[model samples]
Target: MGTYETAATLDFVVDAVPGLSSTTLGWILVILAAAFEFLGVIGLKKYSEHKTLFNGFIYLLGFGGAFAWLYFSFEYLQVSVAYAVWIGIGTAGAVIINMLFFGESKSVGRIASVLLIVIGVVGLKFVS
Candidate 1:
């Protein structure tokens, strides 16, 4: 399908979701934004090492997507809470990915810290 057609289909589907709350949509957007943030950080590392146009473009796209989704999420969540959660997800995800893939330090402290961030994110979600 053409890009426009695909986009139109997606729009229709999103609009058709019955009784979707703005808050729920915001949470979804923020979670997606955080994933993109992780992608952007990885792309940045690649771009830094290779300095290739493709890598740079990928990084830019990821970063832009992250920010755009985060902005949309603000419609349903508090700005501070959404931003914190996004950062928390991105930070924790990056650390875990590094530990898994890069043989980064998986010390007790680091693991504990990541867990703390996760807890904080969950707590914020509940309180908000």
Candidate 2:
């Protein structure tokens, strides 16, 4: 298991966002981590044929970013509620990414799905 307190992980976030407001910073970290997660998973395409040191490093760093995202996520926002919002944001982002970047279908049904997801996210906004 990778140590969470390692200098490398700490350095990563500092590199990414230097400094930011608690709420804005938290959202940025979460988005960055999620994007990294997407790329890391997509990297598996290369893992089977030609794996390189850089890709391996990316994989490791992706998890590190994710851990840091969670750290800041709870630091600025309430855990349960923040997580609920993160889920919504993550879902909507994944769908949009899939549609635009991944060339997946985004018909009316898909658009509606996205809207519904945002609604769920908005609901949490209204909550405490």
Candidate 3:
């Protein structure tokens, strides 16, 4: 079979599994991208504290992986939706990580703001 036809056939076969589709796979990639973004954020924090080749490598690897995963997700999701969701998750996750691990502020307002961000991300998922 030709490349396009082979790919379509594979997709059809994969889609036969319950609760798994191209769109589902796309969302999965988005989540993975966010996870890699978190890794990048942590690497950034470490690199800021200490300038080292290893830390720099970690930072580059995390961010590069994140972008690669996000790019692939675009094939299965709307560009706008994918980009926004990715940013939203990354932003909120970074805030939380800072608060938890970096000893940043953990005040009620900050917590509430994080909640708002989470809600907004969920809303986007539903609307799109």
Q: Top model by TM-score, which number? A: 3
Sort by lDDT, best first: what order? 3, 1, 2
Clashing pairs in 3: none
Using lDDT as the measure, the top candidate is 3
Cα lDDT of model 2 overall?
A: 0.66
- Residue lDDT tens for model 2, 1-128: 87665233233454576575566655565666566656554444345446888777766676566666766666556777777776677668767876886688979999998999899878876773
Which of the two candidates, 1 or 3, achieves a greater lDDT against the reference? 3
Model 1 error, position 120 (Å): 0.2
Local accuracy by lDDT, each model: 0.85, 0.66, 0.87
User: If scored against the real structure, what TM-score would every candidate get?
Assistant: 0.84, 0.60, 0.85
Query: In candidate 2, residue 45 scores what lDDT?
Result: 35
Displacement of the residue 44 alpha carbon in candidate 2, Å: 5.4
In order of TM-score, best first, we have 3, 1, 2
